[model samples]
Target: MLPRIHSKGNYQKQAQGNATARGNTARSHSSVRTTDSSKFSKLKEVLVNNLLKDYHRKNKKAGNDAIYLKAVEEVEKILTHGRLTDKQLKDLQRKFSAMDGIPEAAAVSDHAEQDSYPRRTEVDEVNSYRPQPPPTASTQTSPSKRRKQIDEWSVMTLYNDVKHYEEQKKMKEKVKNEQQRTREELAAQIEERKKQKAAVKEQERRVADEQRKKYEEWQQEMKLIENEKLQKLLEERKREAIELKRAQDRKKMQIEEDKKMRARATMEKRAQYEAVLKENEKVLERKRQQKQEERELDERLFRVQMEMAERQARTALAAENERARREQDRQLRLKAAERMGQEMENKAAEVERNIEERVQKAQDEQYRRDMERERNDRLRHDRIVKENNAFLQRQIQMQEEEKMRRKEEERLLAEEMKREAEAFKREQQRNKVLRHQQCMQQKAMLDKQRMMKDYYNENESAMTEIELRLNAPLLKQVVQEKPDLPGELASKINLN
Candidate 1:
């Protein structure tokens, strides 16, 4: 009986150990499943974060429709493949909002708007029809009796909400991006036009400079030619003036020689007249009446000679007057040539002055044009830079607004998920209590059946004992009791 009791205790302990092992195995499997789910969740979070960062980083031209659409597609793929819950979606939205720096006020208003969606009504309806466990008598549930349940419709609704939010965001971003691109294109076109205008102006300026340079070169050549001609004219005038002076000196010398010759002839004529008178006087002393006629003739001849001399002197004087008139005319011509040369010199000087003025004026005009061009270019560049800065500011503002909107959506989602989770927890608690009650009732029934079976077994054993005593003598007469066998034979018989 002791060995039998000990063996029975051993069997009970073995059964209990097996039950504990099975529970531990179940717990281990559940832990492994939870660990895998946590890993997947972390991976999903990391993927979504990277995607959000990529999208946000592409704020400039990289934020064009193609990249935006690609990012959207990737997000959709993640959503479809990952099958994240509302909580997970909310977390991702929150991450996006955080990265983009969303405002809380906007989130509140968006949440209010979100509550009015038709899907929320569907979710509420589903919530109202939550499955209740059958009635039970217990107020507590056993830990072992607990089980997990999921609501597919609620998950689907949350997925739809996430998708709807993403779609709206995508649409807004697309429109904004297009407007930004258009503005940028317009600015670019304006810049290009300005550049073209500047290039054309520069070309014109270069051409003008070349023309000016050529004109200046031509002016120098003309100046050189004019100066050469003036120099030649002056040299020619100087040579002619020298020749005129030499000719005038020779003419004066010839006039003086003519005067001297005229004086000598007059003296010779007077001397001859005196000699004729003296001879006539001597002849008169010899023959008074005869010499009278001769003296009268001589006197008449002297008078005739005097008249010729007077005529000759008058002729010489007229010739001298003629020469003097010719000298006066030559003097007037020389004065006129000198005056003309002076006037030409004055005209050449005036021309050089005028040319200098024109060149100076052109240089000043070019300087003014260059300065004006530089000023215009500076103004244009400054304006472009200012516009670009304004554009960037506007883009940043829009991004902030978008972030606020996302944050609002995330907050609403989180609230809804929290409410659903609380409700689910309550339901789980109620179900667990019901299961515990059922398990208790089944265990009580099994205990009652086992007690009844033990009672019957004890009674049968007592009756068998009494019958064995009553049949002891007859059993010995009818059949001899089997003798005990050796260990080896007993073992072989038992095996057989």
Candidate 2:
């Protein structure tokens, strides 16, 4: 009972502790939400500034400057109010975006002589307080300068966050300390109560012990008085007992005489009753044996029927498990076959396309080679014909020269032969250049053929290896739990 009370107190304290912890958690979450909201407001400010800058750039008319100033003034006024709900903030942002440098027209159209900032409840407006922005801008600049300013703003925001974090940390620590102090006070009070209870229980036990001792002393005195009265009564009772014993002896003799007379009268009747009781006992024994045999037969029939039903149920369950296993296996195999078929088809098409490209390239190269050979043959035939005609003319010139060998000047002849030598040397150089070009063309063609062969062989080997892997049997898991298939099921499967 004492332990139950202690546990109850401890549970109550623990529940309080849980509640305190939950409150702290909620406060922390609320603070986080506040910080997020502050960050959101900062982002909104930056977005609005950027929008203003863009608007100022697009609408550079002198007439629109007043409109732009009014929009900025109204946005600043909206910010000067207390914290806005998401709906209000969204409405303000949407209105600003759709202003189109015409805030007065929209404001007047809705409500004449009304400002852009909407009104709120009087009590709430009285209670509201606004915090100033870190900074405000009204002009455009190059992106680099704007980016630098944004960086500075980010650092400022970070510093503020750090300060807030420190404050929250201190608050959490203070809450924790307060909770600890309360728990300690509760524990001390509980301890004091336990001590007080112990002192009271000790006093109660001491009093009970004293009362028990007093009761024993009173009982001893009463017993002595009872013993004296009982001794006097015992003497009186002894005299009365002697008188009653004499009267009982006379009554006993009369009862014995009456009993003997009754027994003598009923002797034949007693023998008849004994014979009937023995006959009844024999009939009851025969009936008991018959009932026992019938009960045994019924039990045997019930046990046999139960055994057959159990076997049938187990057999059907095993059949169902086996059928499900077969079905799953069939589905798995069908998926594998389909996937492999697709992979094979893709590989075959890729190989066929590659082969076609290689064949086309080879045919083009052969045609180019045939055309080059035919052009070379025609050029050789023309060169030979020119050489034949030139040789005939040279023979005629040589005969003329021989005739004029003694008649012509030696200087003129020598000059003519030198010119012929130069012409022949030029022709030989051109032929050498042509041969070099032909050799280079053959080398390039050979290199292309080698590269194509290498590419085709590599692709074919890779595809063949992939096909082999796909054809390979997948690794199958072995079931250690052997199926308890019915013998009849196995026989039927074998027959099918």
Give per-candidate clash totals: 1, 0
lDDT of 1 by residue, 1-496 (tens): 0001111124346445544654544432321121222343234335544555544544421222223323344454454333456676566555443444335565456556656764424344323223334423441244234332347755665465456657756976786577456545544654575577578667756765785677578658867976896698679668867876786577568657755765565466446545544654554355454345545665565556556555655554564455456556777666555565466556655755665575567557656766775576577657756765785576567658756865786687679758866886797588678657755765675566456556644442231332334334433433433445456534433333
lDDT of 1 at 452: 55
Winner by lDDT: 1
- TM-scores for the candidates: 0.23, 0.20
Residue 286 shift from truth in candidate 1, angstroms:
6.8
Q: lDDT by residue for model 2 over 341-394, one digit each (tens)?
A: 566556555755665575567557656766775576567657755765685576
Stretch of 10 with least lDDT, candidate 1: 1-10
Clashing pairs in 2: none
Q: Model 1 segments beyond 4 Å from truth? A: 1-195, 198-202, 275-496
* Global lDDT of each candidate: 0.51, 0.50
